[model samples]
Target: MSRIQANLLLLVIALIWGSAFVAQSQGMADVGPMLFTGVRFLIGAAVVAPLAWREWKQLARQGKTPTATDARHIGGLGLLMLVGAALQQVGIISTSVTNAGFLTALYVPLVPVLSWLWLRQLPHWSVWPGALACLVGAFLLSGAHELNIGVGDLWVIASALPWAVHVLFVGRVADKLAAPFLVACGQFLVCGSLALVYSLFMEPVSLKGLIAAAGPIAYTGVLSVGVAFTAQVVAQRYAHAADAAIILSSETLFAAVFGYLMMGDRLNPAGFAGCALILGSMLVIQLLPLFRMGRHKPASVLDHPV
Candidate 1:
């Protein structure tokens, strides 16, 4: 895809992801967090599996079969990614949409930290300020004035750790895998399988919850995981990974907008101020080098993490 096309696709992905926050928040009213995750992931897997299969067929038609070792490596990477998605879904339901959105976006900055720790890869120092800005944005966006981090907030934070790992690996898998579709398929299958096992062993899968949450669950599975995630996979193919991460991070903006427009959420003046700060912080991270130092190209390999 051209850069413009990639950007447009990524924008749509961000929008879907943002809107899915609304679904996740509402879905929690009717289902247990883990159960909701299981159902949503299963649905997402079902939707994406066919696309991946078709993609594989296309590769076969072109007489291009990946080596067995390559397939296995990609599958393993994908499985790890699925685990991250499932955790994020479960975590989102446990937390507020704003908190979930901002905390999740932290994975973008967290990517470099993890890379530094695991691979000894030193991202330029500029990423530090962006990391700080993301944290401040999280605090503001979560409205953490009360200083009482709830159970849900803790869950969201837990979700961030795996998210960071998944993102780092996504950058890896995207670079070598047979495009995004196969990677997405393998990832969702692992997630769905784990969710199914958890549902059977830990929680009772209630038909009542499924019946009640049908709409929200479907919305999340289809738009959030299916369409949005697919776009993320394909879009990252072209944009600088950092730029992609920055663009995808705009899901917070979409979530806030959808919250207000769809659910009649009202933001007080204080909330509005906090929102502005988060937006400014994200923009600064994206445009910092462009205006100031004129340092390096923003195209870090870690761009646009999950």
Candidate 2:
């Protein structure tokens, strides 16, 4: 797919995840974070399993089936997903969806930095300014000025690193595998299995709690995990990791909107300005590359894998 199409897919993923913040928060009313996370992802795995199997069969017919090494890499991605999801799920118990949304978005800035540090892949110059804008926007949008930092916020902040790594790693893997559904299914299975195992040992998982959280688990598992995350893996094959992060960071804005509509969350003038800044940053990053390409300049990080 074209880069623009990839970005559009990422945008839709952001919307799904944004709205899912409410489902996630409500799910904890009956279940522990680990249990909720585990059940939801297991549901996601089942949702995608058939598609993954079909993809695998097609690949086998072409003699391009995935290898054991691919399984290990995908497993590593699952571990990162679990850590990030667990931290966010736990953190959301004490934090408002607004705070959790923006705090989780801190990964937008971290992605480019981590890419540079770990992969020696420097993003386009525009990405630097765009990322800075996203950071400032996330801060203002989070309404942090009105509330003191709490333990939950700290956990959410800590989750950003693993999320950044997950984004970068997803980009690399998607580029190589060209099998987004299989990657999505494998990661979901791995994450779900590990989380369920952990929850069985540490948390009390009863049928009543599962029934109570069934609505949320179904919503999040089917839409957020199954659809949105699979779309992300597909989109990252064409979009740069840094650019994808910037685009996905718009989830904070969508979360704020959903929170206001569903949970009575409010935003001040500063919050609106923050929203504008994030939208502007996304536009700047996306548009700058087109202009650069017109000039026949060297391909930027946005146009190539990074």
Candidate 3:
């Protein structure tokens, strides 16, 4: 797929994830965060496993089957995903969703910085301003006026680092493996199995609670984990990590829109402005590369993976 197509897929992933935020919030009512996360991803793994099998078969035919090193790297990616998701899930228990949203969005800027520091890949110049705009927009949209440092806030902040690393790692491994579905399946299995194992010892998990949370599990497992995350893995094969981060950060905007429509949440003037800034930033970043295409090439981790 082309870069533009990849970006559009990332945008769709954002929409699915944004809309599923409500289910995620409501899901914890019946079960512990780890249980909910574990079950949902296990379901996601089940959903994707067939496709991954097919992908593996295809790669094997081409003599490009995954190596032990590839399995180790994919497992690492899963561990990062687990850490980030677990932190955000646990943090949201003590903090307001508004704070979690804004704090988690920090990954937008973190992705490019980490990519530069680790991969020595400088982003297109437009990514800096675009990422800043996305961060400010997320803050405004979150309706957080003052900086309040709470324990939960710190957890969410901590989640952003792994999330940023996860994005970069996905881009690198996906590009090398050329097997997006396989990557998604491997990560899901690793993350889900580990989480479920931890939850078994740490949290109470009853069938009754699982049934109560079934609706959320089905929605998030099927859409958010199964489809959206797999799409992200595929999209990042062509899209730059920095650019994907900016686009995916718009999940906050979609979350607000979904909240307003479904939950009767109202957005004030600041929220509207935040929406505009986010949209503008996404457009600017996408367009800037095109404008410079004739003169200079945009630097991307996908183009020069370390």
Best by lDDT: 2
Question: Whose TM-score is greatest here?
Answer: 2
Higher-ranked by lDDT: 2 or 3: 2
Point out where model 2 deviates above 4 Å.
295-306
Lowest lDDT sum, 10 consecutive residues, model 1, at 297-306
**Which candidate order results from sorting by lDDT in descending order?**
2, 3, 1
The local lDDT score (0 to 100) that residue 2 gets in candidate 2 is 80
Candidate 1 lDDT (Cα, 0 to 1): 0.69
CA error at residue 96 for candidate 3, angstroms? 3.8
Q: Show the lowest summed lDDT stretch of 10 residues, model 3.
A: 297-306
Evaluate candidate 3 by giving its C-alpha RMSD to the native, one decimal: 1.5
* Segments in model 1 whose C-alpha atoms lie over 4 Å from true places: 3-5, 120-126, 262-265, 288-306
Over 1-306, each residue of candidate 3 has an lDDT whose tens digit, in order, gives: 887898899999999988877777778888998998898889899989999999999999999899999999999999999999899888866765555667888999999898889878888889999999989988888787665668988888899999999998897897888888999999999999999999999999899999999998899999999999999998888888999999998888887887778756678999888889899999988998998778976555467753
Q: Which stretches of candidate 3 lie over 4 Å from their true place?
A: 297-300
Model 2 weakest lDDT span, ten residues long: 297-306
Q: Give the TM-score of candidate 1.
A: 0.83
**Deviation (Å) of 89 in candidate 3:** 1.0
Q: Report how far off residue 211 is in candidate 3 (Å).
A: 0.5
Choose 1 or 3, whichever is better by TM-score.
3
